[model samples]
Target chain A: MKYLPYILKHLRKNWIRTASTIAAMALCIFLIASLQTVLAAFYGTIDTAATDRLITRHRISLAEDLPMAYEARIGAIAGVKRTAKTNWFGGVMGSSGGQPDMRNFFANFAVDAEPYLAMYPEYGLTDADKQAFMQDMRGAIIGPALAEKYGWKIGSTFQLESIIPPYRADKPFEFVVRAIYSVDTQKYPNHARDMMLFHWKYLYEKTGQRAGVGTYSLQIANPSQAAAIAKAVDSTFENSDTQTKTETEAQFVASFLALVGDLGLILNAIGMAVAFTILLVTANTMSMAIRERRTEIAVLKTLGYPSALVLALVLGEALVIGLLGSGLGVLMASTLIGNLGSIPGLQGFGSVAMSAGLAAGMFAVGAAMGLISGLAPAVGAYRANITSMLRQV
Target chain B: MAAVDVQSVRKIYKRDSQEIVVLDGLSLEVPEGEFVALMGPSGSGKTTLLNLIAGIDRPTSGKVIVSGTDLTTLSEGPLAKWRSRNIGFIFQFYNLIPVLTAVENVELPLLLTKLPRKQRRERAMTALKIVGLADRSHHYPRQLSGGQEQRVAIARAVVADPAVLVADEPTGDLDAKSAEEILNLLQTLNSDFKKTIVMVTHDPRAACRAHIERHLDKGVLMTTVERHDVAAPVGAR
Candidate 1:
């Protein structure tokens, strides 16, 4: 505590430089934290997935579809508890005449109404919502996320273009949103927060007698029978001209990641590099401050100051810088994330949620940076000689 | 009682890959209440001997005992503490921290004590009053004239109520008038308070005021005189 004045005096000596260094650290850390948030949202989807449920797509790929007739056959099989079928609507509403109206064409599909609700109870939907959705012929149900995205409601109308094949240059498809179904949890919940569902009959009548169905989502009586059912389900369609690759619903969801393909690994590697840079820059700055305080340390020593007190001085200085920089970084990240819609890159991903876990990680990193930077200089002070130190002009 | 004992002190230095001996078997003694001047040519071991007596630097081989403590026997940490309580140093450059006020500069030594802030302030003010600069207590070191700065240094030196005062060319950077005021302050600190003063200077006029005078040359003390003897070492030689 006696040495606090000395540390503060040293800090005040280079106020501008210290302030700038702290600001730079805060910005870099904040950016790094935000990047991690987006990545978390991406990976968090897979981490929080439900294991009991299963999704069966076309033999070859999700873009291809299976016969709607097979839905009954799959349902009739042993251990087949309940099933839902959802087909991609490929809806695209344009933000501009230019930018491909579809928003990277992320995720929009139509599901088998009753079974889709039964198979996924995590959606926390009310029975009234289920009945309202099922009772209407023009009935269409939308995920709450999609309703907020396009501003649709129980009686709201939605019109969008199909990004799928037979894409017309001039025409956009339309759907009257029946009811909005809620989600149980977020797993890769869309960045735009758009999740769509429509009546299978509507798809059949609109795109009438369609060549194929998108994917069949299933929930089984015996959760352990998933692997066998998946295998058997695939073998039944094995030699039917279109080859099949039926993985468990979990694997099916995990496989969708092939689109980004190793990029996340590259991002993680880059994040490690960025973290190291923060350590170096912060360390170099603190070391410089310590070097400059050599004479002051010597002065204290000459005045009968103890070595332990000197050590505390340097460590205290480092901690101040760390706390300031890290605290600033955390504040900026939380503020930016809290007001996510205003941030530039984040607008594409909706409002980013700043998790407590992310903030804790940042604080820990800042403290470590401070300690590492201060270690060398403080040790140097501890070994100073009062005679020559006082002699330094 | 003798305040400082310097016996056969030896000091060496290496500069630009050249070995240079600064003090060789130099011996000097100052009794309590004595104001002695160490007079010599530029590299004549005057400052080196002063350092040894103050317990700041160790002799390469002989005894430097001050105030009943052998400086050579004390380790670096204990030596600093011993020096702070027993010796006061006035540097040629004044050596006042630029950012600190005169009171704060004087209070620096008290930081080593467990005195509360209020007590430290009172003690610092008293020290500054001894040098007749109590009014300038709040003034920063940089704001003071050369003589006033030296007075603050003197206050810092005597603030801890040390047994011995060591000055290394205290008037080296002052003008004649300022230098005279500093000499008067040193004289008052020595005679009025009976603080033992060991001053190292090249100026013969500065040496003239000492109660005893000593000259060092070729790393050894060659001449010494007292009040009954000559006060100017050059004249004594």
Candidate 2:
């Protein structure tokens, strides 16, 4: 503890160099942490997906619509508990009087209320809100994040202009907000928090497209039977014009992310590059500091400090720098991520906040970097010839 | 008993497969509480002998016994521990750590001991007071003058209260006024505190302060002169 003052003074001797090195390390750590957090958020969507639920979409592509009649047929199959249909109602809420430009373009789903709510119990909604949503055909349940964003209340009415021409083209679709739902952010961080769901019957009636849904979500009695059920459901429509591709909910999310690219390989490559750069910069800083203190190190030895103590002192200095830089970097990244949730069009990307596991992993990497960087310089100090060094200026 | 005893010590350096002998079959002794000065020309092995007595270096052959402990018998770790407790060193350059304040540099050796922080600080302060640099304790080596820095180095050397103080050209870098003050301080430490001191120097004025002066040439003792004007040895006192 007493030697801490000495070590600190030595570091402060070259304050500019020390500060620059620390800042460089902090930037590297921030880049690594932010990248890893984004990757974790992408994978988190798959990890928290409901195991017992299976999604049935068009085999050719998700843009193709599936028949709404398949929901009833899939519900009749063994191990099938309940089924719900959802159609994507592409809506854009633009800037209006007394309202700031939400320019809020989001995935608004037209769903069968009762079955969809039952299958997704993670979305917490009040009983009163659920009842209100079920009673009104033109009612919508929006996520709390979306409600706060657009200043929506329980009885408020809002108009969403449909981009798809099949829906009301000249007149915007007006709907009353009936409820606001919340989900566990820790488990489903990447889950779309700014979502709006209205009645599929209302959309079908308004569009005059009587018998089509975009996707079907099936709830199975046993999660272990999901693969068998998905196979049977897909085979049921194998020869038909509207062929189906069925998969577990997790697999569906994974495949959706696969469209982006190979995220794991890219993330690993980025992480390794950042780590190597940090190691080189920190190692150079430590080496320079030790080189300047060669004579002082010899003086310490003449004062009866053992080689091991000198080595520890050098390594401890490196550790302090590493920890300080990494800690600041992570804190800065966390603050940015937390604030990103409030920005428009960035909610989904920002929803993936830094996880505790990743934060801990970053700290460990910082410490390891310090140890690895300091090893060579500390060894050089330890093995220095006290007699020859004393002769040096 | 002798505070420092060197028995036929020899030191050789090897450079590119060629051996250069610095000290050959050199032996010397200084009684407890006696101040001795070694004067010689450049490369006359005075500093080399001082290093052997201080336990900072080992003899090529023969033994170096200081304060009744044979330094050659001890390994590097134990020898360091013994040196810290028994020998205090003052160098030509002061060698004060540039980063530390005057008092912090003095307090360094005490850190190796089991003393609590308060006690260590007090002892360090007391040592600085003895060297009359108590007021400059907070100043760093760069902030102090050459003489003041050397005084702080002296404080650091004596803070551990070692049996013998080894000084190599202690005033070689100081002005005449500062050099005289340092020599007076060394005389006071030897006479009043009864600290046995071994100083290696080329200055005859510095050698006159010691009770006994020894000259060396070619790694061999040339002559020993007793200073009649100086106070009697501690035993006589």
Candidate 3:
């Protein structure tokens, strides 16, 4: 601790190099942290999924819809406690000129509103909002994030154009907002308030009972019986017009992510590459810094500073750079995450803010990188021959 | 007892499978509180002998007993601790840490001890006062003149009150005026403060300040010159 000033002074000896190295570390750490957060969000849904819930979708593909009649049959399954039907609306909100704008795209869904809301206890929906959504056929429940983005209040009417089949009409579908649901961002980092849910019956009736359900979310009585019940549900619809594939909610989310390729591996590869590059950069910087101070180090040894102390001084400088870089990078990441929810394309990631654990993990990684980077030069310092070093010009 | 005793010390270096002997069968002794100057040419191995006496380097196959401790027998760690307690080293270029102020540079050796911070600063200030640079204690090496920096280096060397001071051409880089001041300061440290000084120098004028001068040539002691002893004996102090 008494030698901290000594170490700090050496860091400032070449202030330009030091600052540039720190900046490089910060940028790399920031990139790695952001990549890790996105990866976490993709996998977080699995960790936070309800054990008692299962999702049944078209076995052929998610693009293929399931029969609305499957809901009643699914509800009758032995371990099934409740069931709700839902379909992806793929709605694009209208711009000021009343044209579909892809930038305002959101995951609007037509759902069995009451049963769907009941399945998700994380969404703190009020009784009044539920009743209002139930009483009016055209009433819709929206996520608080989406509502805030469009400034939609209860009873506010808006037009949405469906990009999916059988719902493209000359006149856009109009619906009134009945409730804005809230979710705990910490508890559900991936399931942010970026989707809208309205009565499925309204879409069915408007399409003359032609539109089918996209998925069925089922709450089971026994979580342990989930696999058996899923098998039973799939077997019941085997060889049918639209075969059913059922899985636990966690497996459902994982499969959905898998459809976009191995994102986890890609993210991990990116993180590893960035870390390796920064490690090399930091090691090079430390080596140069240590090399330049050979005479000074020999002097320190001459003054009776032990080899261990010299090694520590070198490592201490690297650690300070690592920590400063990581601290600044994580701060930038958290701030960016705070504003991500308002971005149209990244609304779902709004709630994926940096956790304390994640932040600490980043700092640990930075510290470890610093330590590893300092090893070669620190060993050189530790084994330095004072007389030989002093003899150098 | 002698403050520094080099017993037939031999030092060798190996370069690309060839052996080069820097010092061979060198024997010397300096009594407690005696000031000695070692004079030799570039490759005469005077610095190597000084380093062995200071315990910064071990002899190839001989013993170096400084302040009654056999440096050859001590391992690197204990040798360093022993050096901290018994040897004060001054480099030719006044190699003070560029970042530290004068007092801070002087206070560096004290960091190895368990002394309180306040007492360390006090001792450093006292050492600086002895070097006649008390007012420039807060100035960095770059901010001070060459002579002032040398004085600060001398202060750093003596701050721990080691058993002996070993300087390798202490005023080699300074102008004549600064060199005289440094030589005068070294004389005061030897006479008034009773420090045991062993200085390696090529300049005959600097060697004149010491009580004895030993001339070396190609790793062997060639001659010895005796001067008037200015400082009292250790017992008298």
> What lDDT is reached at residue B126 by model 3?
99
Off by over 4 Å in 1: A87-94, A98-109, A136-213, A222-226, A248-250, A258-261, A281-284, A339-348, A386-392, B14-19, B99-107, B121-141, B191-194, B228-237
**What is the TM-score of model 1 when looking only at chain B?**
0.93
Encode model 3's per-residue lDDT on B1-237: one tens digit a residue. 998888888899889999999999999999999999999999999999999998888789888888898889998888888888888998899999898899999999999999999999999999999888999999999999999999999999999999799999998999998898888888888888888999999999899889999999999999999988544332322
Decreasing lDDT order of the candidates: 3, 2, 1
Candidate 3's C-alpha runs over 4 A off are A96-99, A146-159, A184-191, A206-210, B229-237
User: Model 1 misses residue A390 by how many Å?
Assistant: 5.0
Angstrom error at residue A89, model 2: 4.3
Give the Å error, residue A127, model 3.
2.8
The native-contact fractions of the candidates, in order shown, are 0.38, 0.48, 0.69
Q: Which is superior by DockQ, 1 or 3? A: 3
Q: For candidate 2, give the lDDT.
A: 0.85
- Could you estimate the TM-score for every candidate? 0.82, 0.93, 0.93
lDDT by residue (tens digit), candidate 1, A1-393:
775675676677789978987786687678778778767766655665556677777766677777777888778767778877777776666545654443434356667788877876655568887787788756666666556655667788656666676333245556666666654335434323445666766666666456367788878777788889888777777777755566666577568865543667777677678767877787788778767666767666656667777777788888777778888998988877766643333334553577888889888877777778788877877877666776665
Candidate 3 Cα deviation (angstroms), residue A384: 0.4
